[model samples]
Target: ILSDETDPNRLHDLKDTLDRYQVYDSAQIDELVGLYLSGADRDQLDPILDACVAAYNVGLDEDGQVDFKGKAKAFARTYAFVASILP
Candidate 1:
C-alpha cells in the first residue's frame, strides 16, 4: 500500500510497480482498500486513498469504497499523478 513517508524512496514507486505488473486492477484495488477500511483503523487507508486521489483524482466514498470501473484509465491516471508528486 502507498503511504505518507519520510523514506528516501517514494511509495509512488511501489504503485508504479503495481501498474507495470498490471496485477492490481481497480477491482482489486477497491477490494484491498475496502479490506483495510473495514477495520477499526479506517485512517490507515487515508494515505492509500490519497495516493489514488493523487493518481486518479478520484476520492473514496465517505464509506471508503473505491469505484472499480475503468480500471486501466484510473490506474494510469493515478500512476501518473503520484509519479508527478514524487520528489
Candidate 2:
C-alpha cells in the first residue's frame, strides 16, 4: 500500500485506515515528522511532511493521546521501518 500509493486519494485512504485502527499517536506522528525533517533533502521533504500531517490529522485523539492502548508499540515499529528506509 505504501509503495503503490502515490496520490492524495490513496494517501487519504491510508490515513483513514490508521484512524480506524487507532494505531498511532500524536507523539509518534511528531516523531515521524522529526525523522523525516531531520534527514530528508529539500525535494523529499514535501511528501513526507504531507504524509505526516495527513496521518496526524486523522490519527490523533481528541485528548491528544493515543486512542488505543499498546498502539504506541506499533508506532515504534513503524518509525523503525521508515527510519531504516530513509537515508
Which lDDT tens digits does candidate 2 get at residues 1-87?
A: 235433434434445555665444566667668768689565655655576566566766655444433344444555555667668
lDDT at residue 20 of model 1 (Cα atoms): 53
- Looking at model 2, which ten-residue stretch has the lowest summed lDDT? 1-10
Lowest lDDT block of 10, candidate 1: 60-69
Candidate 2: residue 53 lDDT (0-100): 61
TM-score of each: 0.29, 0.30
Model 2, residue 13: what's the lDDT? Answer: 49
